[model samples]
Target: MITKILQYYRGFVRARIVSHSPERFLNLCRNHQIILQDLVYRDGYYECQMDLKDFQRIRPIAHKSHTRLFILKKCGFPFFLYRNRHRKVTYISCALFVIVLYVMSLFIWDIQFEGNQKYTDDVLMTFLHSQGYVQGMKVHNVVCEDLEKAIRNEYEDINWVSARIDGTRLVVKIKENTGILEIEEKNYEEGDLIADKDGVVVSVITRKGTPMVHKGDTVSVGDVLVAGTLEILDDSGGVMAQHRVQADADIILERTYEYNDYIPATYIERNYIKERKHYFIQFFDYRFQIFPVEKKENTEIITTKNQCHLFSNFYIPVYYGSCQERIYEETEKSYTETEAKQLCERNLQYYFKNLKKLGVEIIQNNVTIKWDVNGCTANGTIVVHEKAGKLSQEQQVEETMKANEYH
Candidate 1:
């Protein structure tokens, strides 16, 4: 019949028994008319705790009656006291050491790197450190824009670079540049319409010069569509110095159509062999690109990977890895007349799209191809007249940079 109210104190009940005689201690209290009371342990000894008022009345007969000690809790459970001072001290020390070790790891010491193709992770780490983001350098030392610029400048051979910090890992990625473009555009003044492709001249509008063709006229691709200037001369009709100009033209093309019939169709998967990326290791402002060495040929690739700069702060992760994917489609040649025709149509459509940007209109097109039991060959000509205007904004912006700038 115990209630939970008394449980909070871990209270237990015991009947007090004090007897020198073992038999007396074993004797039942009620049978012997002995008093029953509470008991407690003190200093390795049991003390009978009777009410003071009751104690006085029972004190006289206490020696005659054997005192009994019996627990009153519903379940008489053995108790445990706190001990083992040495064990507790050892546990606390071990826990403290582990926490200290973990906190220390938060401070990176040495950074390592891997999965690099063009540049070594160590080189990037050293460069980053020199750029104020090295071992012992607080994370805030490298700004995103600054890091991006630094990587670009340091690794000229890499066409692109990216840098970031993931947890303690700093990833710097580099891509090799694979494009080789003509450095300059040829300059021209005024010239006559020539036959680049036999085509009829349609319409022509001169933007900054004079027109050389009107609608319903036949011309070629290289045929001059516009004149760069007006003819100026002295009183004697002598020629003057010609000024450089962007001769505009819109020469409608002349074309032919021929066809060959055949059977059987084939499909093939093609891979592009051209790709570009730039990777570098920069120390302070100076940088080096290990990949994209001179005398390399046909650099197209499918994927480019890079990692963040490694540093001496944490040897575990110098930088995370990154990659870019590029896919190329091969030009398929089909023996089927219908499929070949579709392919040629698509090609012409794409060509028209490009010509539209040049102020040219493709009013009509005639296509024909030759086919045999072996295969089919398409022989066709595009009739387009285009005019030249101002250079594209992007091109002008690029032209403004006199030289490649680096940090």
Candidate 2:
């Protein structure tokens, strides 16, 4: 491979020689120190390859050997240049393109995360950016071990992490401790089951310990739903032996979430104008915005940035895009009753979505819309059924100390 590559750069030629005595021609060429390679004997001629300089020297030897020599092919940089001499501009552009690619390869252009179930891409990217790992950063400066250590230090749930560079892209792989319990859940193992929030218990099923609160019971935050005491009763319902354990129970509650929002009849509406100005520079994976834009008062600016890759998908160091700053002006606008109601409904729905994310199952949603002269007011009461119990570690410790003192 090395020899072939060097031959391409230094230039070489393939030629055939016909002689009455081929052995004599070969000996003459060797005696004159003319280098030859891949020599093959055909019906009446000897075919071989040699360096460009050797090819020039071969003619004199062929004359002495009384042989006929003809170039079968020319292969190398010199020949290539001669063949495309008229298209020098095209060749120079291609050379520049390769140089640009080399320069771009030195910088990191993309960051990717994998095996991340709990953390989001934005969350990981933001963390990476905060650690000086971002697009356009020098690839050499990135230390994968340092990044992995930093990530492990910052996120306790992550058990293992790996940061590696693939071309211009940085890939982060993480293995999180998904089986780990939450703080409240772990506390519950060592204490009585208490109410996490104020709610009406809809159902209660005790697995261990004694049930303190039954179904349809109203419990406040910190109130024990199940006691950790296990009582042993004799024939006459007399307490003989008692034991304390970690209480366990499944308590579903009907919790209500109230959200109040008022939408103004007259509000400022912002709209971006399509006119924009952009200036950008790109070489390989490097990108820079030449023109800096500012947001004017009472206006919103939207800047869109994009990077380009080679062959549409293959990432190279070359990037081409424009930052379009769409200037938006705000104007006073009045909302109709119907529009205000829709906005209020959207707000309520957004609140419900957030609740659902917490594993709350919505049993009923009651939203009351009040239309005032100025605007509309929406009051929402979302009744959700969800597990309702939390363990108070401090209280559990206090209770244990008190029981020890009493004993």
The number of the candidate with the highest TM-score is 2
Q: List TM-score per model, in order.
A: 0.28, 0.63
**lDDT of each residue in 1-407, candidate 1, tens digit only:** 36443332343333344456534442433454544444455554455533223334454454465543443332122121123344777768878978855554454334444445757776777887787776544455546678779877887776666676654545666666443322244443333333455545444545555666666676655555565555445555654434434554444443442332333456665777544554554443344555533433433333333333334332332232222223455766655666766665566566667566545555456556555565555555555444322221111111121232335
Estimate, for each residue in 120-211, the C-alpha lDDT of model 2 and write its tens digit: 99999998889999888898999999999999999988888988888888889998765423443564435688898899989999988889
Cα deviation of 74, candidate 2, in Å: 3.7
lDDT of 2: 0.80
CA deviation > 4 Å runs, candidate 1: 1-264, 267-359, 389-407
Q: Give the poorly placed runs of model 2, Cα more than 4 Å off.
A: 1-11, 22-72, 77-162, 167-169, 172-191, 228-246, 270-274, 282-301, 306-319, 325-330, 363-366, 391-407
Candidate 2's displacement at residue 324, Å, is 2.5
lDDT of each: 0.49, 0.80
Give per-residue lDDT, candidate 2, residue 114: 93
